[model samples]
Target: MIHLFLGGARSGKSSLAEALCHRWPGQVVYVATARSHPSMAERIELHRRRRPQSWHCVEEPLALARLLAEAGEDQLLLIDCLTLWLTNQMMAGACLDQATEGLIGALSACRAEVVLVSTEVGQGLIPDDPMSRAFVVAAGELHQGIARVADRVSFCQAGHPIPVKGERP
Candidate 1:
């Protein structure tokens, strides 16, 4: 099963994803994509502290498809956020289309249940700069694409989750 969870910053999307992982009877892999910059070091530490010690952590800023391909059928993979991954790719000057296609293809072929958490960036006002605007547009499109392929989609608001498409607990 593929689940897509979307919310704004500090909306408890990650917490929700972690909670959902408990339902799966298999090893849980936390695939984090955030890079540890000076400004985000504290944020990184806080996230690490909150996650379960038993869950395996994989920090892959890109090439998620390759990681997904290596996952065991009995494992459950939770990708913390796609926004950082996209940012990493953009900063690295990687081919966005190819990378996204690869990720989608891998998700479709993977046997293990996958859960993706991402920020909803489309609700805000359009950016003034061209690059920022482009990033927002791309991120919005990517979120929509993933949601389309996801078996379930949920929106998180102020620490509460409302199922957009699929069953809720």
Candidate 2:
């Protein structure tokens, strides 16, 4: 099964995703896409503190498709947030369309249950900067593509999840 959680920053989407992973019967792999940086240290630490040590964690800023393809059927893969992965791709000047396609293909082929968390960044005012605008567009497109393939989709608001597609867990 594939589940997707979407919301604005700090909307508790990650917390919800973690909760779902906790309920999985098999091993849970926490695939963290965010790169460590001084600005995000506190946020990263907060997430680290919340996750159980028993959950195997992999920090992959890129090559997510490769990782997904290697996952075993006995595992549940929880990708913390896709937006940061998108940012990493953008920063590396990677082709957005190709990367997105690879990820979707991996999702389709993956035997393991997967849960993805992503921030909804396109609802606000247009960005004044070109890169920021591009990021927003890319994120929005990625979210839509995932939503189309996701078996379950939920939108988070003020720490509450609202089911958007399929049955809630």
lDDT of 1 at 17: 87
* TM-scores of all predicted structures: 0.96, 0.98
lDDT of 2: 0.93
Query: Which pairs, if any, clash in model 1?
Result: none
After best superposition, candidate 2 residue 122: deviation in angstroms? 0.5
Score candidate 2 by TM-score against the native: 0.98
Deviating ranges (above 4 Å) for candidate 1: none
lDDT of 2 by residue, 1-169 (tens): 9999999999999999999888887899999999999998999999999999889999999999999899999999999889999999999999998899899989989999999999999999999999999899889889888888899999999998999999876
Q: Determine the C-alpha RMSD for candidate 2 after optimal superposition of all C-alphas.
A: 0.8
Q: Model 1 over residues 1-169: C-alpha lDDT tens digits?
A: 8998999999989889889997777799999999879988987888789888898999999878999898888999999889999888889998777778778888888988999999988898999998789789878878878877889999999998899988763
Error of 2 at 66 (Å): 0.3
Clashes of 1: 0
TM-score top scorer: 2
Specify the poorest-scoring 10-residue window by lDDT in model 1: 94-103
Look at candidate 2 and give me any clashing residue pairs: none
